[model samples]
Target: MHWRQKVDYWLETLGDEDPLKIDLLKNLSNEKLMEDSFYKDLAFGTGGIRSVMGPGSNRLNVYTVRKSALGLAQYILDQDDDAKTRGVVIAYDSRHLSQEFALEAAKTIGRQGVQVYLFDELRPTPLLSFAVRHLNAYAGIIITASHNPPAYNGIKMYGQDGAQLPPAAVDSMVGYLEQIESELLIEAADEKQLKKSGLLRYIGEKVDLAYIQALRTIQLDKKAQPKDLYIVFTALHGTATKPVKKAFSALGFNDVIFVKEQSFPDGNFSTVKSPNPEDAAAFDMAIQYGKESNSDILLATDPDADRLGVAVKNDLNEYVLLTGNQMGAILIQYMLEQKKLAGNLPEDGCIIKTIVTTELASAIATNYGIKTIDTLTGFKFIAEKINEFKQFNSHTFLFGYEESYGFLIGDFVRDKDAIQAAVFISEAAAYYKNQGKSLYKILTGLFEKFGYYKEETRSIMLEGKNGAEQIERIMTSFRDEPPGTINSIPVIKIEDYFKRESLDTVTGEKAEINLPKSDVLKYKLEDGSSICIRPSGTEPKCKFYFAVKGKTAESANERLSELVKAVFNSTCDLALHSI
Candidate 1:
């Protein structure tokens, strides 16, 4: 349909409540806006749908939400009455209209006579994942945009095992979603009817207690002197505040301080420009508190509370924010070492990390004689592996992490749990503090032993209509004509995940890749370095991740600077080619 027709359809479907819709409608009459919204429907990719909060057919709003839910409803109902009875669990983060979206999904599923277990209040994505298994529900839904800015929101679908829906299932769901030709015709149950029928139930504290209890078992160094360690924490004005702080207190931490301004669950996220813990500025308030309190460490979780970010006081007594790679490495080392000492390390235990994550973790895992599996960039893949091993498990799940601030310690929650991560990091801090070593020192020791590994990620964000096209163009170029060398290191191999093969750049040899097919390209260099190119599955951006190996900390810092310059220059060159 033409953009104007889609806009007119929206205006007829949603009247005055959508000012942004109307503005987009006015712009749709122009050639520009038409090309944008009419280009394509917001993609229901690997995890589900995520987009800016707006009224276009390609954005996230009531219409999009209903369409997504309708797909899920169709998929579940098609499985027969058993699936309906099994139903779905629904939870939301603290975002604008998140609760409303969750309710809409519940009603849509309820209309199909499916049971719906909805959380009574805002909850993290991991809890929603846990509830799916806890209730033996057929599926789950999490209303969150994760670390995205306030203007964005999303819907993530999960399978019965509490992992994000796999590719085949998502494809089936999208097929069902597309069957509903127009948004105006989508159907939902009456909220009162669903409630009165007893098919829809609201849950909260019981599930929270169960989740927290499971987290306590994952604590490796539980005997650390908690009273001697001073810790600072911040939720960055999102959903993790109460639960995370509560987890810390339950772990016997006596001197943890919270950054007051960012401790509450506020949808606006007033204190920071973006609630993402990946950015250094997001911890400004927490760092200030850390300084004042003379805390040993500072911790923060993103809006949905699935990803944890940490900063520690260095030898200079200045707080240095630890990279996702750094934190993951520490957790892997500590968890494995402790498990080995306790003689509880499973003989067949394994660790998992994404293809784009730092190789230092693989080195650490290898040192402990533990196998490490590499998956695509989402935690869902990691969770999928955990689920694959649960029954008659040959390899017990040890730990899993990605370079994007997401980590999971145990199989308690299938997805990342920052509340649990915070508990483990506090325990690790206390244990190391008693030994008179800082996290920074431990990191240095790891680098010394396993070769210094440094990584940097650059995201080129293109907003609105043209931005997405630009991102697509860049990805296509990389797939078609990859670089031969980067920073004077030969591009020895190019792994095309979409094609499920690794190509030898020089000899032209091809080998199959065992992971699921994805639209990602990774180039392995001769010096044990690598780079990955992928368009953001949830956002209008393309991300380039670069990793380099060095002999020492200073050398690693120098190489990282050089690698950044080279990568940015290459990106500029690639952009010019796209233009």
Candidate 2:
């Protein structure tokens, strides 16, 4: 149908139920907004449906939510007969209309004779992953946008193993979604009737307690002194406060101070420009608190509590922010040293990282005779690796992390658990303090020992239909005509994940990459630097990653800046200052 037809149909069909939607349709002056809203259905990528929340078919609303649930229900029914009996677990974060959407999905599933397990209140994404395993549910749904602005919301689906549904399964669900013609025509089971029939259940503190218990088992040093560790923590106005505080206090870290202004759940994320922990601006309030309390370290988690960010006191007594790569390196080194000291380092132990992550991980793992496996950018690929190792019995999963501040220390939960990361980071800080060292000093020492490695990521935000096309154009241009050199350094090789081929630029030989096909490109330079480009799967942005190694920190930073500038300038006419 034409875009105008879609707009007219939606306006006529949805006028009575949603007044806000009617207001949007009546405002004919905003032709661009109307066209954007009805141009196409919201794209359900590998992760799930994420978009601005609104009334059109291309936005996240009750209709789209119900359509997704109906498709999921159909997919589950197509499985064995017991699949519906196992049912699905539903959780939501503190986004606008999150709980309402969760209920809508539950009713839609329940209408199809499938059971529903919904959370009583908002919870983190990782908790939903844990609940799937704890309840042995057939699938899971988490209603969250994971640090996006207040205008955005999303839904993420997981499989029985408590991990995001793999590529094949997501494709199947999308196929089911395609069979439905109109979102407005979908039906949902009556919420009251579903409850009366015992198909709808509410889960609460019991599961939270179970998750905390699982976290306790992953603590490396239960006997370590935590009293002297004055830590400052901030939840960034998300859903991480209660569980994080409980876990830290239970572990005997009594002096942990909470950033009061940003402690509670506020969907607007009023305190910061963006809720992303990777951005230094998000840590502004936390840093102020840290200085006032004379804290040893500062920690912050994103909206869903799946990603963690850290800052440590430097020699000048000022808090210095550590990039995700730096934090991952420190955690790997700490875990290995402690495990080896306890005489528990496994001979077949291994760590997993994404291709874009810092090579410093390999350097640290190599020192302890551990193997390192690389996967695609998403954490789901890392989770797939963990599951693969379990079946093959070749490698024991010790740790897995990405450069985006997501980490998993144990297999208790298949996704990144910032609650666990917060605890482990605090404990690691305490251990270093006892030995007369700060985390910053430890990180510097690691860089000195392992040839100073520096990494930086720049994201160019492009929103709406035109922006998406521009992003595709940028990616296709690079893929077809690869760069010969970057910042005066020769390009030694090019890895095209979408084609699953690696070309040796010097010799003109092609080799296969033993990973799933993805829309990512990487350039390997002669000086051991790497430049990778890929569109963000969850957000409307294209990211450029740069990794460079040098003999000194100053040299590495200089090289990194030059490479970043070259790439940005050569690409589309993007703002140079954005980098």
Question: In candidate 1, where is summed lDDT lowest over 10 consecutive residues?
Answer: 570-579
What is the RMSD of candidate 2? 1.9
Query: How big is the positional error of residue 221 in model 2, measured in Å on the Cα after superposition?
Result: 1.0
- Model 1, residue 35: displacement in angstroms? 4.3
Summarize candidate 1's per-residue lDDT along 132-226 as a digit string, tens digits. Answer: 98889999999998888888889999999998988889889878977889865778888888899998999999998888887789877776667
The C-alpha lDDT values of all candidates are: 0.85, 0.90
Best by TM-score: 2
**87-119 per-residue lDDT for model 2 (tens digits):** 999999988899999999999999999989999
TM-score of 2: 0.97
Per-candidate RMSD, Å: 1.9, 1.9
Off by over 4 Å in 1: 15-35, 570-576
State the displacement of the C-alpha of residue 414, model 2, in Å, after optimal TM-score superposition.
0.7
Query: What's model 1's lDDT at 119?
Result: 98
